[model samples]
Target: MKPINLAAYFLCGSNRESFCDRFPSYFLRIFRSKECPPNEEYLLCGSACPFNCSNPRGPVLCTDDICGEGCYCKSGYLRNDNGTCVTMDQCVGKDEVCGPNEEFLSCGSVCPLTCKQPEPLVCGLACGMGCFCKAGYVRDTANDKCVTPDQCPTEQCLNQNEVYDLCNGNCEPSCDDPEPICTKICKGGCVCAPGLLRNSAGECVSVDKCGNYTDGALSQYMNVINKILHL
Candidate 1:
């Protein structure tokens, strides 16, 4: 059998009596190798370790008492099953990384939406500060515009689904409905009836009707008629 490297033995605690007692064969093998020729080629199991104390590889070396703790292979290093180290290609992009909530997918770039809340938001076209897109209004995908709902022109009915007004912005029934005649503000004003005219007392009546004159005007006319007819 080939002799073992003494440095490996020392690092394995062969120098200590308690350790040596457990590894007596290791000491005997090394002692017997002394009688061999000086140039004899001995097979060394672990003495050629690059991390030997004589050629220590910084703080990464693992001796009998020093095992790697909290040591992670660097970005380009691969950890071995036996706690040995090797090099690997560096990880390039964040495509595979994911947030805790996993709500958003990577676009092979920066994370777009905040994964914590991940709620969809309407950007670009917006209404007034207090206003949002009303019902039947949707965000136009082509231009990012917000468009109102499509309406069927039901013959220009008034108030336009309560969306429009008439006569100086005052809401009037049937204002949006198509009519033969347009609206007009009468000089003497008007009541609810058609062909209704305001008499001297501001009461509504038909032209040349009994309620056309005031009480005083009627009395004056009656006096004139009494004189004329001798009544």
Candidate 2:
């Protein structure tokens, strides 16, 4: 403070002017640190929280106030855990991997086809992301494998006169209602075999034998009809 260094002041002013003239280029170089990789784009103001395979939609509300410049995944692509940008189909994880007859899905139906529910109804409107059975195939819970519907284990019925129905109807032919309208819906269960009808005694018999039943002797003829139907 005693004596001002005129030469030092002159040098300081000259250096400050040079720094100010190169400030824009220096700032640009700082932002562009490196070249962006494949499937990525350089942004002047990139999001602090970017989209990833686990979080495809990204953060719902980004509260970061600091603006930064960097390379980010482009549209229709997301960064994986390895920090590599890829499409949804290529963003498979350890759990998202699928086996034969199965495929990975980013948004698949929740109600996938199964042996028990080959013709499953729309369970809900909600969807999920995971591996699911492919078309023309159904999941077999018994073996936890995907197979054709016909490959499902055949259901064995207890009664000899009854047969297993994959898609049964409520309108079973009976002595009272020989011909009833049935709705087309899958109701899997056991039903009387073709050419057989349920009688009043809860026994399956031929159509011709239904008219021969008498009020008092109906129970006695049940054993005979059972033997004939089983044969």
Candidate 3:
């Protein structure tokens, strides 16, 4: 005879014990004071058996056709307050949504698509232990949408780096450049002056190819110098 399933019998409760007592002696096993009973009718009830035990005699699949309604709904399924369909929204991270292939659950809400947060109502990029939203995004009303923190460009992006040195009205060392400026020195003890390049022997040569140092065009080279300087 098949071994009596103790767990199944326990779930079946007194119905299983009474059924065994009324039927075959092979359905019952006594070990010390413990009496194992045969399978009682497996009553697929509530959401726990949402597909109605998968038995042909089971009820059809419907959100409202939950077994054991108000009592149990499988592992993840929950009963609605009105006791109609299982509450799909209660799944949250548990089921996310009823999977397309499974008949156990129905659709509720699309899970929130944010990176790491499991609950659908949360917002913004999921952060590390100590990290906060950097700049461009902010915590929205639902705590969702790491939205543009401030109006674009009007207030400028927040400097995420804690320490900042200001150059004029902007951050120093320019975000794009590494160096500040290049200083020039002439080899022949001659002051080649700014706005000019030196030759091999240290003769100050106009960047424009040897014009007088006092030429009005020197101011133009000075402008170029300022353009290349980062800070």
Candidate 4:
């Protein structure tokens, strides 16, 4: 190989003892290659992989991936949008705070619902801070949304696969959406079939019902918005 370019590599592995015989000045054994090589051809496999990281905050670490070993940012640091290490604080979102009976959080609403206790979260830490449900309202673990007990269907046999969802009494496959972008996963929203409507009793009646979809194309942002507006 080109020895001039070899100045950028380090001598390592069991072959180091032998490679150094021809290039004694460039030998670094297991350490970083701090010296440059002379201008000429030289054996290359005798050299070890070079790790010339420029991170000033921490030592370089190696982790295995499909491409073998890979470089990663040091602990408490993360790669930014530009692939540079930034302090952990930069990676973490700002704190958040809900309302009474809700929890205050440093992260945004999209963050996962978790608790600080050693055991599993009670009510799965059901409620979150900010615009929490009105008084006497609690979040339903089945759907992870806030609702008053009266909102739930009295039947208690409701689920995504049941004849009707407990929260909205819509038929199964309520979000019969064909749009690839919309999700069919129901999170307690209600929709009725054509020519049907949701009666005051919460049952689907003729031509007067409600509606609902899949995921990425649409979001439950409207659902939350409606909740905020008490719609």
* Candidate topping lDDT: 2
Give the higher-lDDT candidate: 1 or 4: 4
TM-score of 3: 0.18
Candidates' RMSD to native = 30.6, 15.5, 20.7, 18.0
Q: Assess every candidate by TM-score.
A: 0.14, 0.50, 0.18, 0.21
- Comparing 1 and 2 by lDDT, which wins? 2
**Residue-level lDDT tens digits of model 3 in 12-93:** 4557456555643323322211221121122224243332222211234446454541223333334344443233443234
Please provide, for model 1 over 13-124, each residue's C-alpha lDDT reduced to its tens digit, 9 standing for 90 to 100: 5456565577766655555445434322122232222221111122334454433222233222333334443332212222222122221111111212221112234454
Global CA lDDT computed for model 2? 0.70
Task: Judging by TM-score, tell me the better candidate of 1 and 3.
Answer: 3
Per-candidate Cα lDDT values, in order, are 0.32, 0.70, 0.33, 0.35
Once fitted onto the true fold, the runs of candidate 1 whose alpha carbons sit more than 4 angstroms away are 1-128, 132-192, 210-231
- lDDT string for model 2 (1-231, tens) is 212234334534467666535574553443343356888776777778776777653566876575567777776677888989888777766344465698756566777888777787766887654567889999987987889999988788898799877776456777666665676656667779987888888788886678865443443445556788699
Candidate 2 residue pairs in backbone clash: none
Better of 3 and 4 by lDDT: 4
User: Cα lDDT for residue 13, model 2?
Assistant: 46
